[model samples]
Target: MSRPRTLTDWQALAARLTPQLQGNAFINDDFVPAVSGETFECLNPATGERLAKVASCDGADAEIAVRHARAVFKRGGWSRMAPVERKGVLLRLADLMERHQDELALLDTLDMGKPITSALDDVAGAIGSMRHQAESIDKLYGEVAPTGEQVLGLVLREPLGVVASIVPWNFPLMMTAWKVAPALAAGNSVILKPSEKSPLSALRLAALAREAGLPSGVFQVLPGFGHTVGRALALSMDVECLAFTGSTTVGKQLMQYAGQSNLKRVFLECGGKSPNIVFADCADLDRVAESAAAAIFYNQGEVCIAGSRLLVENSIRDAFVAKVVAAAERMQPGDPLDPTSFMGAMVDSTQHERVMGYIRKGIDEGAVLRAGGEDVAGPGLFIRPVVFDGVTPEMVIGREEIFGPVLSVFGFETEEEALALANDSDFGLAAGLWSQDIGRIMRMTHRLESGQVFVNNWAGGDQSMPFGGVKQSGNGRDKSHHSLAEYTQLKSVWIALS
Candidate 1:
């Protein structure tokens, strides 16, 4: 079937998707309200409707959760379980998530205005992350270090007690899976603090873990703002490790909290202002143009590794910008429930205003608006695909992370200039470059500071690849054999042979 061309059609489809949604904190295998009896309204960004009034937990609630998690960790009901047995429990939780895919999908779509189909698809990634870690349990082996016959050395990986994860709203379920999946699979009791903006999915996931026969306090969710529950978790001495995916600023705070308290291991996957380079030698201009548009426009450009900076070789700059602008026009925001809508609403009004403010600032700084510089102007917080040509490095839009569908295009004459432009940022999360030159590709790949680099593509990678950043973009990797290691600590034991 062809995509819906009318706004009414999209609206009708979205209307059918809206259902009453609500959830409380999930702790110790049950749903419970905040000790303070406070709650916050979860609003649908697409239509400004109330999805739910979720419990707003404070420091006291955080303490209770940590105490429970610490008790379970000490008891070792899960931590001491055999590898295959732990794997089975995690696999069952994944199965339960798959069974309730649609229900989980709807909660995220209504809560954060993510496209319903995309939300549904993201659930698969989350499930896959769980299953992958679960399946790896028994296969993982400890190392026998080379030593003299008189001495035997064993290096074993052991679970860190009471892991706490704080995930962002943009990709709620997927990010949660990246953190919690490994923590739980590694036999650590987990306390998750999902972003207040979108907490419903994580709340549901906690229940599923309980249903899958996880011990009490083995998996839990605390849905509230970062200042309260999140700060409390970061500062808790009982939480031996902290894994987070959010802003660089907040990631730094968590590190500080860890220092001030227990000095827990902190792993962060934070913000990015990743660059996408288009060189003159690329054979496929049309394909590259389309992908470049999608790189920044996908998820309304809320993605942490979004290619907000488009660096094109000067030879193809004018023509390429025109092609990219044309492609972006077709991707204007629509009802998130419409599967055909590649773009959706901003997570909320604050984000919407922030994007618009960046657009105005860019124009003021002399960036020529080549395609779009406006909102869709309707019920939702939706923006049109914004493209700015003739952007320079000094411009605020060119330098800062917009976290919107605002594309800033810059032109470079040589590979050296492109590399310089790409490397000149506080972020090093991911970068993409387009070229047919093998030597250049090899050199650029070596020089690029990002954790991941794509050759001739944008955001192309598999589950096995590590994801994270360097510099202010934050530390530690997620979603690979490496992530499982981050959730654990290495112990070395030596035995003297008789």
Candidate 2:
């Protein structure tokens, strides 16, 4: 595909696209509007221009959606479907997603301000997840207990009803698929609440789900503000379970709401302050430096598992920092529609301002600014990647979760100190360790307090592996056979015979 050259080209492409909010909410086999007939504007983050008007669903709309989901679950339209049958639907949905990959990717790029290439990759990843979940659906078996005296006991896994999924703005479409595909595969009805910042692709996914033979009300999409729609979903008693991918503060608030309302099952993938450690025995310094730059600069460093903290061994700290700074400087921010653009704007002005504020804070806190610390002047909210050296564990920039392309480098004297520094954070989503020493890899893998540890590489994982975090980073796994369990509940059956 050819790249868009100017703002007019981008706008022309967006104008030709039909926004998903034009479609109605798929509730109980019908496309319906919000109860209040309210709607909100969906903006293109790159240009701060309104793209479409989406339904601004509120508490009453959430209640209606949840009720329909509950009714469908109780009526056995989805929850009672055979595991194989559900798997077939999920696989079909995956196929449908593949069919619409280009459109979906474009929607994501326009709505979420991600580069089109990366958005296309996200669509492909979503398809892969659907197929992955389908493959594991029928193979998931419950334990069988041995009993004597002509008595038999069987344990079975059942679906959790009325799951409310709230996805993040960064990877909106991909995260929706992450929750929806697995939850549906496990035979649960879902009420998805896409982030207000970027809800177009998610709404589009809902339409596709219905087209792919998923029963109506089995999947519903609500687009609105988090304070209104998201809060309602979290506190709804009918929402038996909640799955969220967002900031730690919102995750915590949802947990409290779940606890206060019905103590619903809450699964969260929250923020991260992941450490990327570089040891002196690293195999390739150039590769490590490039990886370090990409680790914090990819997707504008909006990734929840982004390697923001760099812990380098003192022997090669100076050289590594210099190389990483040089690498980061080579990446330029431009329009998302430009295929050659390595980086794009932040999701919106708010996020853009937040990231810029963090950069200023880093400077004020006495961390040495290595490279690319200022916000770029453009119509879009673009901030250049920033790297800081002489960072300590206690500094605000070192401890806090800044979901942007900002890297903090700290020198470590020994492996013990490196491990300690890596683990010394409230968030433990993911960490990357660069070293050729087998013993060091083993030690760091065991010592690093993260859900995923990447050795040499960064953010390397498949749908077959579980993805999540420990401590304040939130609980519950996202991918693999483990995610299926999160959507299912086990029931024990006992039989007695004379």
Candidate 3:
């Protein structure tokens, strides 16, 4: 069957909807422009075409957003609502999200160059995350301390007022839902700053939230460069909490800003140099090879937790590398709108060039290019998936977070050496171990210094488990009851008997 031609149709659909800047920032229960009249253009990464004009909010606008959020929180618009009522609103929001899945998916694909199929899945995941939080809210309970005296002591969780959540470009819509749903479920207003590279879905989400009856000022979308709007959010005193998912460098800067400003709670899920360790004892070599390729190439490898470093036991290193290289060769970079296309363009030209440069550096540094080591010339930012074998731990390709469809394979003879190689990097975001021995799995899981350790698989976490990283990968967690603490403050109530 022929592939359907739908890119132009999707673009037209996006053109029909009013752009983000056209609608004012949702603040104080109304839509209004920023204190500044500045604006920025959203670029379609696939074609470098102008997608839409978005608000270029400055510090003044951020101040207005935070103040409005504070007002709404104090007024009890969302915070005072019963848990069931809030759940109903969030559930309705999820339903509304489902209703507009096609539009949201199309916008996401056009703006971000993600596969249309993946974009649709992201919409579903976003809805699922929202509903998950809604259901989890009622089960959230405070703690009680046992006391010998007649006095009673109780601990309660309260909203942390306004939270500044900065989401990344790769999974813009789903990440925004991951941050906002839990914050709203915990009774905190949120000011979301999506990556300027991909703000279309976030703006659409803001509109949907309003349509679903979210109180004004309870949710706001600020679309601007990281230097202006993101800086404002990181340093805002009224934003009592800050949650970020991006690079460790920026995460550190935001941490410093938070320390200098309000000393607010900060949650970060930063970069990764995750290891996908393969052992000779593995059950299925073909499945392992396929999963490894998918692990590094999925979403064009923009994943923060991507298993970029492949540690293969020396016994089967040659064969495994051959299999992985063959699998990667089968995957091709094509127009994201093409349903059969397995890989899309990089988020932008700069990222495209960066990935290509890394490939060149790998060659220059003596790593063997097993497959795909060049850029595909095109109007859009596209690079073929690259794989490098015989990579040492000190090599740039093995140590750095490429954030592209590139894989570095390292060979180790002993299990201890595999663990050493995996834990060599400063990042500890996510790692996977492929071994048949249960004792080896347990030993590796305990030794690997990563936030998430997957055994015989890769990237299998739901909204229920805590997701975050250690070391330079950043701190705090997302997705689960633990996330509520990031958006909430604990208070202790003490009563004395006379």
For residues 1-498, write the lDDT of model 3, one tens digit per residue.
232347665545556653533435555656566678887777777778887766777788888888889999999979989888999999999999988888787777777788877788788889989999999898888888797588888999888999999999999899999899999999999998888888878877888888889998999988777899899888888889998999999999999999999898898989999999999999899999999999999899989999899999888989998999889987878887766778888998778888888998999999998898877876788888898998997789888888999999999999999998999999999999998999999988998999999888899878889889999998888888888778888899988865
What TM-score does candidate 1 get on C-alpha atoms? Answer: 0.96
What are the per-model numbers of colliding residue pairs? 0, 0, 0
Give per-model TM-scores: 0.96, 0.96, 0.96
Q: List the residue pairs that clash in candidate 2.
A: none
What lDDT is reached at residue 382 by model 2? Answer: 88
In model 3, which runs have C-alpha deviations exceeding 4 angstroms? 1-24
Q: Name the better of 1 and 2 by lDDT.
A: 1
**Local distance difference test, candidate 2:** 0.87
1-498: candidate 1 lDDT, tens digit per residue: 343335555455446544544468988988999999999989999988887889999899999999999899899999989989999999999999988886777678778988877788789889999998898878899999999999999999999999999999999999999999889889899999999999999988887888899999899899999999999999998899999998889988999999999899998988899999889999889899999999999999999999999999998888999999999988888888777888989999999999999999999999999988888777899999999999999899999999999999999998999999999999999999899999999999999999989898888865688888888898888888888999888999999997
The regions of model 2 sitting more than 4 angstroms off are 1-12, 18-24
List, residue by residue over 197-229, the lDDT tens digit for candidate 2: 788888788778888898878999988889998
Q: What's the lDDT for residue 142 in model 3? A: 88
